[model samples]
Target: MKGFTLIELLVVVLIIGILSSVALPQYQKAVKKTRLMRLAPLIKAMADAEEAYYLANGQYTPFSSELDISWPDGTLAGAATDDGYLRFSDGTVVDLLSGSSYLTGSASAYVMGKTKEGIYYIHYLDHSSSPGVRSCKGDESLCKSFGGEAFNGGWKIP
Candidate 1:
């Protein structure tokens, strides 16, 4: 009588498994959310720095040193490559492009943004045109598309 029966043990195991199945997904979602959130400050900093650089030089500087950012690992300073993607150590990516989009003209317009887990934040600016944030709640694919008249098609940062 002191020991549990097989049926009781099985029932307990089943309950535990069911709870874990439900909880694990939520835990993963929270972790992904946190990872995305951590990029927000960096994105904002880059945008601010870009704007300042534009004000000072009349155009945004692609060099990370000029932007005055203490870049983390995997930070791509400028359009070193054709993709214009800045890969982070955490697997998130940022695309800081000037003008219309990556591989486009040179201008004061700038976009510093990041995407992770289908969430994205884009700080867009063009001194003579549009300037604002383009945020995609879900679906990274949607984020890739130009948001609207107020938003320009940013570079595909992966």
Candidate 2:
């Protein structure tokens, strides 16, 4: 008599469950977006460094140290593997694509970052062509949710 009946308790539990189910996905999305946003600044810095290096040397270098930029903490500057990918301590993998003759430019470079959730972000810079091209490759809905435009079978980020 003092407490709620079984039916009333069950209803309360059901409502709580429903609310949680609705909120969980949104929380996860926010987490994912935050993770992606964290890498944006790093990508921009890398692009700037690559551009400066290209102007000085007339070519891009795959080595982060050669660019003369101050890398962020937890960045493994010496941890570049044979495939030219750098792994961060926070499970982010970055690959600097440089010195490729495929694009028409004095030098073309792209800094790609792959988050722990398997979302790939690419910041492409071409000195003679497009100065900045930001794109994301992953779940279409997720990409679009974070303000990505559909471009050439990929999501172009603003």
Candidate 3:
């Protein structure tokens, strides 16, 4: 059996390390973006489900029943539930009553932002806060007029 020289092994290890170092952050960011992106579809799906529930009952709200949810795909864990309240691993909240964490519950309606803290927004993040690209709401600077312009009383999603 042939054995590799220490120098050769060191060079190979160094090369692998360099490649990993350069690619790791990019990989991490991509994963983060992908995870954050799931919020959109999740929001849409939840909104649709909630709308259906509302149409059937004439009031909009995610019933306090077991909801089979797949949390952050890229970063968050899988097979989550809203049986009690929407909660992220980092303690971010997303329930209709507990709109204190990431945008999950009613936020499936409006306002969205992704940070290391996770996707966050408020109940009725904004009225003018369009669902287009780069529409900022829930941030104090934008909702400075008091009563939070995005805080539309009751649900907004249909």
TM-score of each: 0.65, 0.84, 0.44
* Better by TM-score, candidate 2 or 1: 2
* Model 2 agreement with the true structure over 104-135: per-residue lDDT tens digits: 36444577788889888777776634458887
Judged by lDDT against the true structure, how good is candidate 2?
0.73
Identify the leading candidate in terms of lDDT. 2
- Which pairs clash (backbone N, Cα, C closer than 3 Å) in model 1? none
Measured with C-alpha atoms, the lDDT of residue 127 in candidate 1 is 55
**CA shift of 66, model 2, Å:** 1.0
lDDT of 1: 0.59
**Colliding residue pairs in candidate 3:** 93-101, 124-150, 126-150
When summed lDDT is taken over every stretch of 10 residues in candidate 3, the lowest stretch is 127-136
Model 3, 1-158: lDDT tens per residue?
A: 59999999999999999999999976875665454444556454544454455455554443434233345554433234443345455444444323321223333343233434343433232212333222213333323322323334311222
User: After superposition, which runs of candidate 3 have C-alpha atoms over 4 Å from their true positions?
Assistant: 48-85, 88-117, 121-158
